[model samples]
Target chain A: MKNLNRRDFLKTAALGAAAATLGTKSAKASEKLLSEDRLGVLVDTSVCVGCRHCEWACRLAHNMPSPALDYYSNPTVLKEFRRPDKTALTVVNEFENDKNPNLPIHVKIQCMHCDHPACVSACIVGALTKNEDGSVVWDDGKCIGCRYCMVACQFQIPTYDYDVSIDPHIRKCDFCTERRKEGQLPACVNICPNEALVFGKRSEILRIAKNRTKRKPDIYINHIYGESEIGGTSWVYIAGKDFNELKMPPLGKNPAPGISEAIQHGIFAYFVPPVTLYALLGTIMWVTKRRNESADKDKHDHHSDSHDHHSDSGRDPYRTSGHNTYRDSGHNTYRDSGLSTDKDTKGDNL
Target chain B: MKPAPVKHRFFTPGVIILAVLALNGLIFLAVRFISGLGAVTNLDNNTPWGLWIGVDVAAGVALAAGGFTSAALGHVIHREHYHAIVRPALLTALLGYTFVAFAVCVDIGRFYYIWHPLIMWNGNSALFEVGICVMIYMTVLYIEFLPIVTEKFMGKVNLPGFLETFNEPADKLLRMLNSGLSKTMFIFIIAGVVLSTLHQSSLGTLMVIAGQKMHPLWQTPVLPLLFLLSAIAVGFPMIIFESLIASRSFKMKPEMKILSRLGSMVAPILGVYLAVKIGDMFISDDFKYILKFDVPAWMFMAETGLIIIAFVLFLSKETTRSPGRLFLASSLVIAGVLLNRINNFIVAYKPLYDPVAYFPSFGEISVTVGCIALLVLIYRAVVIYFPVISHK
Candidate 1:
């Protein structure tokens, strides 16, 4: 018995240790703050010429399906709104310029790569991670394809390879993580004809974006779309019209996961709430058990007092009546079926 | 007293239909596994969860609340009168969770990596909490059902062929297991209840991170509490619903006195649930959204309206006294919770960018229907073979 108990203790200890390590690993991902030198892109939508060269360049860089570079140059494709999907990692949609209706403003839509990404916080398996380079990348090897990330992403940027039967991966812009490794600019930035997309350190780009907005207040909107929106995104946009007019969702300055994590962690902090709940339930059970025992004792005394009368009745009236009708049916078929009306009155009396 | 098998013929038209549905579901499942979720489901990136998660997982988990509630009533609370229903409720829960896990397997794109959550713990993730809890609770449920299995096979382990040689040893093992389980059963029962409470609420927490995606009508900080309360409210009703249906099907007398007492309990629980739900909406100042006449608004109205009706009916003496009325009231509660879960997880969730609507494909619906049919078939089989349903 001692040996068995010791073995059980050892096994439990090992399991607890492993669980603690894994818990710390998950917590670390959330605790890591945005890096100071993280890269970002400042998109001056006012200067974008609606060329859609970035779309062609992004498809080529991601090695996704694409028409020839010339096919993307067709301005007619901008008639309808478009979103980045599994086939396309990035897309450019043209919005009718409210300030200057003659020239349409084109906004490139891709992963915003928020400082505190909802997708990373939502992933149960820690498959999506926020890297130091301001890139929110997904590890296909770690993904369980739960798609909670897709549901949690505020921008709805992550797309799934739902068509693939085997080893399908979530598709999204990685901010050209591989290209950055070679010290090369993002495909869309490199391919922009008018230098509309300015890539630099996040702080440096934010300074430039603020300066541009201040210098050209008449030509630009008084806001940076991604700055402090859901805790600030790596991709900032400066448009000539209201950001809402460009189909950008109006979000609060607070991080997306703030309220959610606070509520979840508040209730489950150190598992205190669950433990308290169990204790409360246990107390209820104990009280009920004691009350029931006393009630059973009272019934026992009452039964003993009428023992002779019950014996004369040839059955314990309390036990063999009312709700116990089905129990009695197995033995006394005549009483159950033939004397049904008599039994009903007797059951009611009991 | 030990439960005994009900003597019912196996080949009813209802059973045949259920079998057909189960078989049809199996065919779709094969397609889903081989051709991926896209072939069998209309689920895309915007709508990752469809009928499978909403109906099969969420509703199924809520419906299975009868297990913990019954166990708490019978063993922990020492309400021996409820003992008659505990076994059946436990069986239902065991089967319910089993199918829930199976549905999850089919729903996830990488089905083979389902075990990853166990070792790859993300304590901060509500889904991680839900997954771990459900997995542990399922095991606890099965453990709680072990004594019944032992009771059924205790002295009847006589085998007819080469296996006959091990019959005596099996009987010994069975007796040992039965005795050992009885000693430690309360631990598992308590664990089951704790785990159930954690996961039931965590299911609501799973959607909290969706934040702005979920409609304000269903999304609130108090959502987890509401989910847990609703689950608790529906627990006794689920058991009552199952018991009344089982009695009618098996040609047994409905335990009216006991069932009416159970029915009476529902009103207070439903009262608490309704109060919390309405209060949460009012406090959160989301009641204005109810006037929008949108799909989510209508769904919220219907969901709350059903529960209110059920609560009113349960409070009435006539409804509690009549078995049919009681069954109807219980079914309403069940339907209300089911609608609440589906509405929160699917109907009320709208992606920010995607204007495209999502409706489960025929194959997805079939798979969900088949899962329910299979559950019923298994329940019937268990009651017929094992000592699940009460004979006396």
Candidate 2:
């Protein structure tokens, strides 16, 4: 008995340790794929001319519908702030520069591709995944077009092909994944006339962003927009105007999925909670069934001794006996059923 | 002592209306599959989920929680008096889950890929947890309902004409299944309750990922707990309401004794839900949103107000004992839960670039109404043919 008791304690201790590990697994596993030398883009709104050349180049590269490159130069369209939609994978929006009224800040809007991407966490079918290269990519074959990614995105970058009935696609910026395979920069970076968009290793470009901000503190805001928002993003921004005024959503340092995943893991750690609940319910059912059975026996035998003799029997007899009581109680519980007509008629009047 | 099939005419003026409503829904449902969700639903890139998800799927799941709650009370607690409500509750859950699955299929862009979630699992996703648990629970519900089928046909497997030769064999199979299930049903019963707790809470976790998009009034870390508690609280009222309506429809005596007892237990559950909901609001300092009294605030008020009113009603002996008062109280809770789900999924979801506030399109409303009408029709049909409701 002592040996068995020791073994049981050891087993429970191991299980408890495993459950503790499981509780923290989600946060750790999600971070394991993040690489130090991951590619990223630095967007300097101070340098961007709002020429919209990157917009034309992005469309041409993506093989999506676009007019001539000259059509993008038409500044009239930039009058109204445009978001990156199904048609445009990236767009440059002009913001009012309060410091220098003549020179407006043209902030490019696209997928920030967070280090801890919420879309990847929220995707029901693992359709979206964050790559080691710092690009959050979507698989065509995997997407069910639920558009939960739209709801989860802090930037609201993903757009659905809603009008298309058959094989509707979830459209979003893929950070020029195809072009990068051929050792080329993103189309936006390639077409930037003023070097407003810088593409390089995330850590390296972050250093450059900090240097530029320190060198020209009067010109650029001290804070780098995406350095730590939602646990950092691939696209870092150095802008002259306030980021909040630029319509960049203010987010905390914690990842979008942090609190939610913590709760999820807590509830489902090694499935212990569920199994324990099941066993607890089973025990309650067993004990209560026996008590009810003994009560019923007491009623029938009209003797306390026989009721006590009914003992905690095996599963087979107890289950069958429980059903027998259920069958009998159908009448006793519904005793008012036979007399409910007049009362029900009155009840119906309400 | 045994439950027998209710003997009554199937159709009436109210039923005709329901049939027409269902027909209207089917037409719209067909339009959706053919023309795409954009053609029928008010959903766009900004607002992805609307009436179909909020009312049809979320509210449907919440309202159908009677199955596990009753099972817990009747079988697990061994309250033999409540066993009469179990079969009906099981049937309701089975049908409700079926409706939820169908709504999901319709809501998703690629309906054929619906089975992908079963194979392709994402542990990080709250939705994935909800999807998996709901799938397994549906299967468990079916296994639990098999006893009713075997009981109805075990000794009476009489086939007609050419099939008559196989009647004895069929009877034997039924008997075998009956014996096997009688021994094994307890496993499925406990499993159903466990799964219900898992997915019901995970359903709340679904909107937690929405973050800033969700109004602060409803958005909190404790949403899952609130959702689970609300689901349990609403469970008994749903059973009470269904029992009263079923009896009235069949022109039979309602099981007032059991229903009244069920009613007495409701106030405490609702109280727990209220305490948690209000407590979370105060602790999180989200009570400030409630003071705003804007549309979202009013919607929140309406949601909690219904539950608060129902809770007060349930606390009184006058309400629990009187069938009319109990019915009214139960309806309030059901409506409150329905509104709460809609508020959580639709009204509270304020996305960036929302040009206009989303309202359900006419097609969307028709489809939602049609599904409920169909569910009720099916419930009526099943109880008339099967021994679900107990009576003398």
> Which candidate leads the pack in TM-score?
2
Clashing residue pairs in candidate 2 are none
| Stretches of model 2 off by over 4 angstroms after superposition | A1-25, A303-350
Compute the lDDT of residue A221 as modeled in candidate 2.
82
Candidates' DockQ values? Answer: 0.28, 0.32
DockQ for candidate 2: 0.32
Query: What stretches of model 1 exceed 4 Å from their correct place?
Result: A1-32, A282-350
Chain B TM, every candidate: 0.98, 0.99
iRMS per model, in Å, is: 10.2, 9.1
Error of 1 at B177 (Å): 0.9
TM-scores for every predicted model: 0.88, 0.91
